[model samples]
Target: MNLAVIPARGGSKRIPGKNIREFAGKPLIAYSIEVAMRSGLFEKVIVSTDSQNIADVALQYGADVPFIRPVELADDYTGTRPVTNHAIEYCRQHFFEPQLCCCIYATAPFLQVDSLLEGYQELHRQQDKAFAFSVTSYAFPIQRSLRKINNGVEPVFPDNIAKRSQDLEETYHDAGQFYWGRSNDYLSSKKIFSDHSIPVVLPRHLVQDIDTEEDWLRAELMYQAYMRDHN
Candidate 1:
């Protein structure tokens, strides 16, 4: 069986009620749940959350809330792997054993069905790989990055300052959207950023990290622009 686990803890410090906060027209998490269901990639779409309110919203949107996430696992310090592992074990005990699982983030408003499908296909194409997750190229070359020092700014990599942009290697970063992996890999607590994982690249315009109010505003603008262009 294929399972999709969405870990949405209630304690969002940066943006209170972040997981279920309204975005665009519907609840924020509704986007993730809707997209996951629309992808048709999983036998089950589960939302593991500590908030009853979150559970209610998830159910209202057609996602199963078979279990309320434990308070211990719902803390700010808790990571995605442990929450996912707990979900996997719960499924094994109550439902059919899941072979492949996808961890879809509740805050991923920009997540696309095609990216999820691509991750699934990549995992199948490379059986040896442990994971396939969403990523996107950095907007600017990281080699020329700057840092504030006292009253002045300095190049992070002084050696690369003189190098041409075309001469530098392109880089990418995690889009924080979703991750597709074998059930065993998640259970084993394997590292996600290593060579064991492959990336499902997304366009820069379609990627935004909504951690703060400014980020939220920027995302709304990006989403509006994207919708206008596509529609």
Candidate 2:
């Protein structure tokens, strides 16, 4: 069975109470929870959070908070891999071992049900040896990326010094929206990317990370526009 895990901690330095903060009249995490549930790909949606308020809100929005996240995992320095590992082990101890796992973020409020399910279906259809993640085309050509010199001059990668944006190759970036992978693969690599990692393309507008107040406002606006267009 596939299990969806949403990892949210109590200590958020960028935006306090970000997980439980209201968005579109509901807590932000609710968006991810609802999308995962509506997708119908996963048999269960579990939220691992250190905050009681976050756990409560997740439960109210159709997510199961089976256990409170450990204090060590809640620290700011803790990387997602360990937190995911902890949650997976926790589930295994209580329930059956999950075959597949989708790590959904509480910050990605605009994750589409169709896109999510498609990502899962794509993973299975390709029978990919690695993981799958949702990503969007980069706004700019990464090949044209420039770095600032000590003298405040822009240094180009090719050193051609004059390259047109259109001439550069297009590349995609991880949208940080969500990722799906086999439980065994994740346990082995401790990462979502592998030789066969599948990048499911999504529109850039649909990908938003709410790490700050301004980001939250932008997400709200984008979400409203998205709703209107769909309607």
Local accuracy of candidate 2 as per-residue lDDT tens digits, 1-231: 988999989788889888888898888888899999998887789999999988889989989999999888888799877777777787788887988888989888889988888888888888855678988888977766788889775756775446787777778878888888888877785456656688889999999878888988999999999989989
Model 1 lDDT, full chain set? 0.93
Among these predicted structures, which one has the highest lDDT? 1
How large is the C-alpha RMSD of every model relative to the true structure? 0.8, 1.6
Q: Could you give candidate 1's per-residue lDDT for residues 153-194 as a string of tens digits?
A: 999999998899999999999999999989999887578899
lDDT of each: 0.93, 0.84
Best by TM-score: 1
In Å, residue 75's CA in model 2 sits off its true spot by: 0.7
| lDDT value for model 2 | 0.84
Clashes of 1: 0
